[model samples]
Target: GTQSLHTNGMDEALALPTEKAVEIALRTQQIIANESGVADTVDPLGGSYYIESLTDAIEQQASEYLAKIDKLGGALHAVEQGFIQREIQDAAYKTQRAIERNEQIVVGVNQYQTDESIKPELLRVDEQVRIDQMAALQNLRAERDNDMVQAILGRIEQAAHIPNAPLMPLFVEAVEAYATLGEICDTLRGVFGEYVPESWV
Candidate 1:
């Protein structure tokens, strides 16, 4: 899957991808497909014992982690307990530390030194965009039947508490009734209180 990489505005030190960088990324994929003949092979790294061992190890570890999560009363329980969040935070911290210490060399970041002036145009969302969105939402609410929307929302709230309830059909019905996303989400939030993560500090 081809996708664009986006950099955060907060990371001022990080340089945005230049035209040359974008060309290189696309060209690299083309080289792999044509020159390397990677596309011709069904399983390129299939014969490598190291690769097979690594794959098996990764699968085994993932299965073990899933079993642990199941024992901890599944994914929702892990999230509520901040187990999943902590694991992600720890991994991110480790990766960042590695990059900072030059243990991991990222090209154009820690390695490739370039002073070439590259100013790429960045996309910015204007305040009018938000204003327009709000106006549209307001117009929708004004045109929709408030009584019917409330009734549907109430049914959704009830269905949420009921086990094995086919809530997707109810959600589709709510959408068909012109119920705004905010209204439906707010109803669910009221039913299931917002999760507050445990202090890791």
Candidate 2:
């Protein structure tokens, strides 16, 4: 699945009743689990000529990349300088071109011509859910001790300002003080200012 499927519209996906979500997940798992001969076999495509050649080529290419990154002072430095992002973009473009030119055949997407419309039941979040969540947040803030929260937040601020200081403890303390995920993220955004990369023009 695309990362967008999980991160971008996931809250709406999860807004289904918990039981329905679990059932859907279980069904998906079962389909994957029961895929023909996958479970009993070790290296299912071991004997396929094309599969072996492609796998070896991919492995060698990855090894070359690892070696290049090591020569360039490792993964973190490469990431900070956008090497990884550029490589990913190049690879994605190459893959897309291959698919478009029929060099690749992706099942049900480009290869299989399925005329059936995919009409799955999409779960919707009601206005009451939003209202209830706001009320819950307000109640939580009202019930929690403000003085302790402020003290913890001060400790968090101190940790953020200090060089090489582990901020996990401050995070734990904030969580213990009943600070919401949104609040923690907002505070970090205030310190870090959000990072937006220059996408390809």
Candidate 3:
């Protein structure tokens, strides 16, 4: 069963969605949920030949990719060795080449020639948002048990080094103790180090 949904705005590639874009995205989900009769039944298109074939094809491709990752010792190992980064880089490069060569038609970006440039309106967060958040964080640190935070953080660091150690509980404890994301990530960074991708460009 579906639990949650996120509908991306049309202008998401350019910038954060403007208010109008957000409204449209939300309305799309709302219409699907409220107006569309498809939501009345489960797997409405499941019996269709084309849909079943497409789903099977998607599953097959996904399984192949998962098998490749398993051979590379799972996701974390592959990422550490830069396999994922290189794959992403290769895919992006291929897409860009296609777009540039007219093999891919990207409307205004590639195929259409416009006499004037048109920029979409983008959503802008207020500068005070960061200031307010920092103030809240400072207040949280001033109030919560820092000793507990440090002790739990130490446990987290230790657990991270162990092979296949469960860490979600420690993370929950850290968050409950008001440990900032930066502090927790810094501990992991000290253990796993950062993944700096080799530029293919």
lDDT of each: 0.81, 0.76, 0.91
* TM-score for each candidate, following the candidate numbering: 0.73, 0.71, 0.76
All candidates: CA RMSD (Å): 5.0, 5.3, 3.2
Per-residue lDDT over 78-104 for candidate 2, one digit per residue giving the tens place of the 0 to 100 score: 877788889889999999999988899
Colliding pairs, model 3: none
Ranking the candidates on lDDT from highest down gives 3, 1, 2
- The true-versus-predicted C-alpha distance at residue 176 of model 1, in Å, is 0.5
Residue 26, candidate 3: alpha-carbon lDDT: 100
For candidate 1, the per-residue lDDT at 201 reads: 38
Candidate 3 whole-model C-alpha lDDT, 0 to 1: 0.91
Clashing pairs in 1: none
Q: Is candidate 1 or 2 superior in TM-score?
A: 1
Q: What's the count of clashing pairs in each model shown?
A: 0, 0, 0
Ranking by TM-score: 3, 1, 2
Question: Can you write out model 1's per-residue Cα lDDT over 1-201, one digit (the tens) per residue?
Answer: 113334334223445545555566677666766898666767777789998898899999999999999999999999887889888999999998998899999987777859888665544457899999999999999999989999999999999898888889989999999998888999889888887778763
TM-score of 3: 0.76
The segments of candidate 1 whose C-alpha lies over 4 angstroms from its true place after superposition are 1-37, 115-120
Better of 1 and 2 by lDDT: 1
